[model samples]
Target: MTTKKYSRLKNSFICFIATTLLILNGCKTNPPNAPDDTTDLGKVFISANVLGAVIWLNGNDTGKITPDTIEAKTGMHEISLTKDLYYKSTENVEIIKDTTIDLHVTMEEILDIGKVYVTSNISGATIFLDDEDTGKLTPDTIATNSGVHQIRLQRPFYQDLSKEVTIIRDSLITLNFDLVEESLQTTVLLEDFANVSCNPCVASNQIIESLTKYTYGPEKLVAIKYPTNFPSPNDPFYLANSEDCDARMLYYNISFAPTTIVDGILYPISTDSVSVKSAIDQRLQKNPQFRIHVSDNIIGSTYFTTVTIKVENGSGINFSDLVLHTVLTETDIEFATPPGSNGETKFFDVMRVMMPSNAGESLDGISQIEEEVFNRQTEISTSWVTNKLHTIAFIQNVVTSEIYQAGSTIE
Candidate 1:
């Protein structure tokens, strides 16, 4: 072969190999209509109320969290925002090519707002919030908002209570209340031992008449006068019911005339107002252990009396051999003239009859709260005036000789 022919052939083969290498490299670099990034594709901008929320696009991970923009195709895509302590919010969004679509998501917390626990010492009390009935009783739970609120507790026969409390977020607020009991009225009894013939009885009687009309009226004091057979052989008032008069005189151990007893305690039988007022005041200061209520019905000569005794809060009290006495008495007994030599024309609060033979009913000592009711019907004698009659009930401690409480029918 010639030298010129060899050189030319070698150069041509080398040039062809170079051209093939250039074309292969160009094909591997990029294809036609292919882009370096998604510059022309649609974008999805996601914003959420909660931070650090994971974002998903078209059931695929976008590798981007919330408050970010994701490049997507021009079509409908499911966009989701999720977090550990928040509810997942999802929506389908349509993307427009070369444009951004904003997605605003509102996520809800996973926990409740607040809770409240209401309780009271006494069960079955109604609960109220902000003056609105909650329809919930005591020892119950309620779901409410987090803030300041007013709570009220109410029950029958107990004082109502209201209070203000603050509720914390994602926490429980407990409210406990102790109720108070209602107040009850107190009553007292006055026992006067006198004979119409006794002259000193006139002044003593006058003093008692004024006391019965005190500020408290009929509820303040109750008087029962028993006529005695002292200082006169045949006292008309005493002879009217000698059995009861003598029984009372012997029971009180009265050895003189015009003796006055206030709740089984002896008081001076004189016109001195200070001594009488002091004795009555001392009895009124004592707290009564029992409450007495009496009612009566009269039908011709038949008298019906009902006595109710309630042992209220006997927690620290002890009773031994207690007796209940129901006595029928007449008030303002007009004699037109002096019934006896006492010169008193009117006899007030005179003992007419004793129920249950005067021995009284055996009241069992109660160590707790309790009530006892007694009823008696007796035929009234024609000698006693029925229109002015009243029933008096009392509870007495036999061992201590102290009268605990007394009540009566004023009318």
Candidate 2:
């Protein structure tokens, strides 16, 4: 019986060892849950503005050229950029697990509306902003809200003009006009570039007055009479200012007497309406960066002058170099002419003299004034006035003598 019992125990122990081995083999055959293949993070693409420029990721300079791709972690990443004439910009981005990311940037500069031009047959015509007068119908570079605006035109003895204008993505807009004349406020500078014995000066004055009356009423046009070549004993209103006479011969390099300069340019009797309109209209298309608000104050002896300039900021252009000048005008002075100008008299809004010629400020520039936040200011003063004086101030190029803006005290 003892022998049988020992044999049974040994068999049982063997069975237990066999079962343990089987379980261990089964565990080795099937493993726990885990990923099968290796995963990868995404790449990042960096691109600066349209201008070809360098880009940096974090602090390291990626050898990759612009529009380059760099290795990145699958989560969040920070970026830095550097370029010429531009400020550094930083941005945070999230890179996807398998997809690449693209980024862009923006920049700033000086000068808003580089230039504005307006042209019409009636450039000398009055212009209105909203309901206020904006000097003559010249191409203006005015900085205004990016929206719709009302514009009106008017001239002496002619029909008035009114319209709506839009300022869009571009800073420049050319406003052209086609107009008809009803009345004329024509000023005939009847220059007799002839000898004292010349008799045609008489006929020229008559024609000039007729044109003035046809364009504008009598209150508008002025007739300045002068003799040229040989001095006439009857000379009254003649000054060397006229190119027709000996005094202005060297000044204007002209040797003719029956010549006239309309507005600020030389205009002969032969100029047709189309040519006239074309010439005047061309000036109206130019955009000016600065505007003028002339204020004349009576503070003691000196006339305090304030010229407020409103400049618009945008785009990539900047307008610099500012200079201010003022002119005085007096009209309705009667002068003896060859019969035709009798009682017709003469008038002049003469630019007598410039006030404190050094009022200079950069009208349209990339940066603001040193207070370092916004715009800047400039002004000058003069006490000398003859009561008939009206002031016009403008921003001009000191070397080129080209006026960018014109403002009248009356405006």
Candidate 3:
């Protein structure tokens, strides 16, 4: 070959080799990359509680809306979502190669809570708002939603009072309840003497129960039924404690199956509602010369009570032989079968025990304005329901057998 032609051919051969090397280099899997290589991408699905929210990634606009999926490099990424009038949501996400991630966000609504105060004539009245029990009593302050609601105050003796209230945001609403007492008079005591075996006692018991159901209260009229042996020899109540029954029987000189005594005066043998109510009305008309207050603390089957008797507006009648009688009574007593021939299945306000003795404690005479206090501690028997027990304390004129004042406590 000629020298010039050989040189050209050699150059062409070099060019061909260079072009082949370039092609091989371009097809290589492992190539030189920048410092922040974002080629390895992952996917993400995002959703939020609010609509029309803008999404941002790594402080830069992703140009994507919520409930949409996006593609990004595999690494830790900062995501933020924002909407008008709602809290902004921020999250940190880690993306993995060939893996998809899901994100959900929720925004909170701003609300202003209000305050409500409920009060009544007596304390411990349960408060209810919009028929929902607040688990609060009278003279209490409660945090409630800001709106109009119905309010109800309920207690044992006092009539339930209801009212409508409107509460504004960040405002206070006060509700006052002048609850009316059920009985129109002060405290009164009713002593009932009966024999459980006597069928007539059932009618008398029904009459007394009817009166007590509407007017019964710790502060109003209270009753105690004595089960005598004549009615039934197997009387459960009489057998439970016979000493108290015998003592009360001797005091009242009771000989009948059903006899009701109001204060100190005995009513006619008729258990008619008119006759019973008449006797009660006469006693209620008279203003009691003294006031009694009873309080108790119960721990398990043991109960401790404190009673105070304060004489007020005494008409200068110096009482002789004033006795403070503390009696324990049980209500809502039930029996699987009738314990006597009376066929009564339920008994209420049955005398259980007398503190000290049925003879009672002697008290000093109150001339005008004086007071007497008594403290008693008693351990209840397991045969009786502790929750159904109560305490009754009264001052009586031993000579007249008249109950001047009385106080009772169920708790």
Candidate 4:
């Protein structure tokens, strides 16, 4: 063998080695259709029979509604679709890297119904379902479609209550609400027609005052003494407001002084404390159908009185021919000498004036769950003490002669 033959053989072996290295490098490079292992994400196309169903991925809201595409990490994921009035649907899916998967869900409609027993701490509350009045009261069962619903309870003189409840199919749910009552108290009115000149009025007035001030207090009873012209026509209280005094005296058909009227019922003329107390106790047992609030303030020489009347509940009582009477009275009147024939030196709750006449303002249309406000202003009389002035208001049925409620500014 020659030296030239050896050199050519060595060069051929080196060229073959270089060709093999180039082929190996080309095989190591990734192909265009192959997936890159570095990225751990996949695309999911979600759709539902109900187009607006919310999509949840791995128990987290994907912030996307159905019929949309979402990107998620490559792993086993739980997909759920939720829509109102539809049963929730869930499915488990496996996602491959750089792969796209399609998911479709069939939503089921909620056709089953359930019963809810509605009740409250106080009965007679009207039931409302989803803002619609069901025309049903508490302690009644209402059939409703299975779903999430808003329940509301409403009643007169109570704060309305509301709650969100989920009704399960073929199940019964019991809901009870604690109702809050508006602050209200029934007050009795005692109208006593008396004169300072009558000797019997002194004893009657003392008995009435003792009951109204101490025995019953202002919460239970209110008394107004209207000066009468019977025994003494020259009575100073009668002279102050003769028109109202005379009108009230004739309305009740009073024949003499010291006559008492409890509510609108005429009572026998008696100075006995036991008789007066018995009459008042009868009226106190009646529940209040209306709430009366009276307030007064003095501005300049004018006395302003405001009366607010609210119907607390529906008692099925006829409200027709109802009248609201507001009276201005002077209390704790003291004098150095008796003003009339009687030797009485002190008078309390003397009728000063009746606003808008004794006929009273008509409350013809007042009804349940309603409020009426009246503002009346009267000129302050120079003879009456300003600090001792008080206002009293009451609601009465003129036809039946029944007083429903009464209020005063005594406190």
Give the candidate number with the greatest TM-score. Answer: 4
Model 1 lDDT tens row, 165-220: 88777888788999886566567777887777888888888888788766345676
True-vs-predicted CA distance for residue 29, candidate 4, Å: 99
Q: Write the per-residue lDDT of candidate 4 for residues 1-411, one digit (tens) a residue.
A: 132244335546543553354234332232211221244678889898889888877554555798998776688988888775566799999887898999999999878978799999988788998875566999898877788999999765577899999988899999989999767777999999898889999899999889989999887899899887656666777666666776686576555667788888747445888878988998999889888877676643467888888887756766668899999988999988898877999999988877866889988776566567899978765455677989989998888788889999896
**Candidate achieving higher TM-score, 1 or 2:** 1
**Per-residue lDDT of 126-200 in model 3, one digit per residue for the tens?**
898777456588899876657777899976445778998887788887789999854434677888877678888
lDDT of 2 by residue, 255-344 (tens): 333444333233443223343333333433555444344555432223345555554332343355444444333333344553232233
For model 4, state the Cα shift of residue 366 in Å: 2.2
Clashing residue pairs in candidate 4 (N, C-alpha, C atoms within 3 angstroms): none
Locate the minimum summed-lDDT window of 10 residues in model 3.
28-37
Off by over 4 Å in 2: 1-277, 299-302, 313-322, 334-344, 357-387, 398-401
Predicted structure 1: lDDT: 0.71
Runs off by more than 4 Å, candidate 4: 1-182, 266-269
Q: Estimate each model's TM-score.
A: 0.54, 0.32, 0.55, 0.56
Inter-residue clash pairs, candidate 3: 197-231
All models: lDDT? 0.71, 0.43, 0.70, 0.78
In model 3, state the lDDT of residue 12: 64
